[model samples]
Target: MSIKIRGSNAYGHSGWFTVYCRICNRKLKIGTDLVYKCPKCEKKYNAYFCEADARGLKWKCPYCNTELVPVI
Candidate 1:
């Protein structure tokens, strides 16, 4: 089984990316929507949250207990 990951430059594709809120599964748009990322463990956990979800989480990384940072 092979898992294909879609990411900016994931397959030599540039200038394209999509993010989603881990909590509610809402699609997040950069620049247009406020986003938060967990710096301490984002690489491993892939934690991304939209504004409302981030606030609901108290701006903390649920996995690592690290404070979340704004994407912008």
Candidate 2:
């Protein structure tokens, strides 16, 4: 047998986005992208996946018209 690498470096489900609604805090059943558009206001979001891994991207809440100021 040859001495070679025999492992995998593939991206699995746990390392990717869960694709859910931030406002509703529910997993989306239709969206299929890193960016999710709110059906109600057509607003896109990175989504708050969890407390340890928040994807709280700054963007305007089209529904509420609230400017999500960037935390710079």
Candidate 3:
């Protein structure tokens, strides 16, 4: 997947934003929000996904079944 930087002044902060999921071409909304980064697939999500729900202790991506690395 590819990552892109999108910026806006909606939150009054100006900077580069890292966006994941190239296939989906998704853009992040401008605001204070939370995201869970998947290590293997390098995907981002809005909610907390448990390892069990993600299907293993390896912290894999729920969408691609690849191991996920948490970014906080």
Number of the predicted model whose lDDT against the real structure is largest:
1
lDDT of 1 by residue, 1-72 (tens): 998878764685534556878889888777778889999877776788999988888988889888999987
TM-score against truth, every candidate: 0.73, 0.26, 0.30
Q: Which candidate has the highest TM-score of all? A: 1
User: Whose TM-score is higher: candidate 2's or candidate 3's?
Assistant: 3
Model 1 segments more than 4 A misplaced: 1-15
- List where candidate 3 sits over 4 angstroms from the true fold: 1-15, 18-26, 29-31, 43-60, 63-70
Query: What lDDT is obtained when candidate 2 is compared to the true structure?
Result: 0.41
- Ranking of models by lDDT: 1, 3, 2
Which residue segments of model 2 deviate by more than 4 Å? Answer: 1-9, 29-35, 38-72
Tell me which residue pairs clash in candidate 1: none
The lDDT per prediction is 0.82, 0.41, 0.44
